[model samples]
Target: MAYERLYILVEGDDDKRFFEKILTPLFEGKYDQVKVWKYAQQKKEKVSQFLKSIKGMNADYIYVSDIDQEPCVTARKQYIQSKFKEIDKDRIIVVIREIESWYLAVLDDKSSKRLGIRYSNTTDNVTKEQFNDLIPRK
Candidate 1:
């Protein structure tokens, strides 16, 4: 089914920014509207409640979060499914280890140099703290 609108629920401001930068270009001309919601402060229960409330909306929904220390992406995704069974299985994306890994994947040598951070291929082991350290404070 082709969706005219896409609603993305992300874990934090960084996740929102990452989606804005990445998905916008990747999904350009595909969706008539794209909205990203930063729900970092909400607990898992609250997030599930919000998802339940948004059911039947005329839009495609996507939830993105870091896998953290989960056994694997499948486990993380299954955990989310256990809480929000209404959500489409394909729309839930759990980044391996952390969302910073995604950021790292896109960062080139030039960008890393400009940001004054060394480029490290540490996606599998990147932690929230390490991710935060790499991001330049505004």
Candidate 2:
């Protein structure tokens, strides 16, 4: 399906930056524009407000959040679904552990070593604390 625009609501600035770097190139000619909004980890309230504000807007919405401390991915997905029942469940993505896990997965082995992180093919086992240590502070 063709979409006029794509709206991505993420947890924070880091997630926004990550998506812009990764998605912008892939979606450059697909949509008129792809906008990423940072909800600052304030999931439910911010999402509710965004949905209400864009009631009639012509755009595809994608909500991304980290499954932190949740029992499992299913439970996390259920929580997000309960918050915004109107949105399509397919658009909701609950990242395992955290977005940092995604970063680690995408980074090449050389890059991982440069960042002092042992390259792991699977990120599901990586903890947030371990990922935090590898990130260079600005």
Candidate 3:
């Protein structure tokens, strides 16, 4: 099935760069089937505002900020559902703890195993700075 578009709403530049670098390559052939666009906030974007922006854009999938602010899982989930009321719950994937997870996902298998983590995934309560050290800057 061809995916119309996948819109990922990130909080900042780091999240945008990290995801595109890691996830984009993995979905190489998918480019023909799906298009991923990154939407970043100019300021502190509230969930309500972010959702509204995405809704206006008519995205097929919405990956929104789920982590950060150290919010608990329940709070994050609830906020996501409530804020993005117009979005399809199935297509709306809340990326809980994005920074650390996106970074870990792209790490070599040996590195991920040594770190006890995987790309596109992360351990609970991991900090971005801690994960940042593991990923070399280009």
Top candidate when judged by TM-score against the true structure: 2
**Model 2 Cα lDDT, one tens digit per residue, 33-80:** 888888765667767878666556757778888888889877888887
User: Comparing 1 and 3 by TM-score, which wins?
Assistant: 1
For model 3, how many clashes? 3
lDDT of 2 at 55: 50
What candidate 3 gets wrong by more than 4 Å, as runs, is 1-3, 31-59, 69-74, 105-123, 132-138
What lDDT does the true structure give each of the candidates? 0.78, 0.78, 0.58
Candidate 2 ranges with C-alpha deviation above 4 Å:
1-3, 41-46, 136-138
- Residue-level lDDT of model 1, residues 19-135, one tens digit each, is 898886676578878888887787877777777765756567789878876788888888878977677778888877777677777778898888797877556677778878776
Clashing pairs in 1: none
Global lDDT of model 3: 0.58
My TM-score estimates for the predictions, one after another, are 0.78, 0.79, 0.53
Task: Report lDDT (Cα) of residue 5, candidate 3.
Answer: 49
